[model samples]
Target: MASTHILSAYDEELKYLNRRISEMGGLAEQMCGDAVRALVNSDTALAQKIISDDVILDHAEREIQDKAIVTIAKRQPMAADLREIIGTLRIAADLERVGDLGKNTAKRVIAVQGTGVPRKLARGLEHLSELALVQLKDVLDVFASRSAEKAEIIRARDEEIDAMYTSLFRELLTYMMEDPRNITSCTHLLFCAKNIERIGDHATNIAETIYYIKTGAQLEGERPKDDTANTVGAPAE
Candidate 1:
């Protein structure tokens, strides 16, 4: 009876971790979406909200870390149980970074406010963010489903986000070169685009973690990356 009670308690703890992770994932998704919308529309109020809400993700990450550590000390989990706990830690870190990226993009809204983003550039950013958000949402679903196959699919599709970012990077550069006045706004947009691109990278990292948790093996081969912005003399700013 004692053994059974201990097992039940462990299960409950794991479930709590899963629930917290899902909550974090949902908030990260919302922040990423809202950040982009705020940027395109120059909504300082919404941007400020995103910036403030990032603390929630930060707190959740620390909570998950504390809980995982305590659970490991108490439960002495092994094999699959250990993998699950470790995976939760990894995913939580990635999700926190995603929230940070969203906050960074939100911060750029103030810099570009009143400058008016070009309609074409706005559309490009929208498209890039849409792809990144879809990847993030799908990867979070993979975490819930524990579907390694689906995780693999999500991992492979990260190249698509990279390709889109490269295209947008080129377009932004062309706009800057065409007019000296466009440099400041376009530079801010460049950083925002980089942030969205990095969000996709984090999603891919979560997908890989899901795969590891399910399979107990690291993924084979280097992650496929197609982001060529650096080679094209992309600014570090």
Candidate 2:
């Protein structure tokens, strides 16, 4: 009947959106890596690459949004179908913000284009990048499978990222205070830490949005904070 055909089309749309989302994730993840590498090595070439590559992420985000809009307009979706469409759109917005955060980090890397990073600071970035990427990858899994439990798990990783960010923030602050000469380099590293933290946040935002689409529950104070991060991928409060 009409419902069956509608579902078939909906499934096709979800598949396409999922592919685009994964592509966005891949690009954002690479951008984060390139941004980090650019910071450690002061490689302007890599920084420039990340800046340029952001276009692909932006395009993917727009395409996903357009598809979601069209799907909503064309189909009189049932409750579950409507949730899936809304959820995917929300997730796409989060991925786009992820792209923005990566680009911002790259811009900061470009600013300190020739500065040498401290060894201690370099070591911290290694850990931060790993944690951030893991959170991002988990959200993609959540989207594909619609697993609320896995979404909750992304929040746990966000906590780990927060702790790492706080520790790194204090350490860098102390280093800058002790040696004014370290200020420029420390500031660049601070942006890297902050960008990584924000990436974790966007992933968290996607989790909460998807959870709400599924359950209609706002996961404590997750609502207001999500509104801020989804717009620009800025650090969550």
In order, candidate lDDTs are: 0.95, 0.79
TM-score of 1: 0.96
lDDT of 1 by residue, 125-227 (tens): 9999999999999999899999999999999999999999999999999999999999998999999999999999999999999999999998788899996
Assess the local accuracy of residue 165 in candidate 2 as a C-alpha lDDT between 0 and 100: 79
lDDT of 1 at 54: 100
TM-score on alpha carbons, each prediction: 0.96, 0.87
Cα error of candidate 2 at position 168, Å: 0.6
Per-residue CA lDDT of model 2 for 140-173, tens digit only, reads 8787777777777677667777777778887888
Point out where model 2 deviates above 4 Å: 1-3, 220-237
Worst 10 residues of 2 by lDDT: 223-232
lDDT value, residue 71 of candidate 1 = 99
Cα lDDT over the full model 1: 0.95
Q: For residue 195, give model 2's deviation from the true position in Å.
A: 1.1
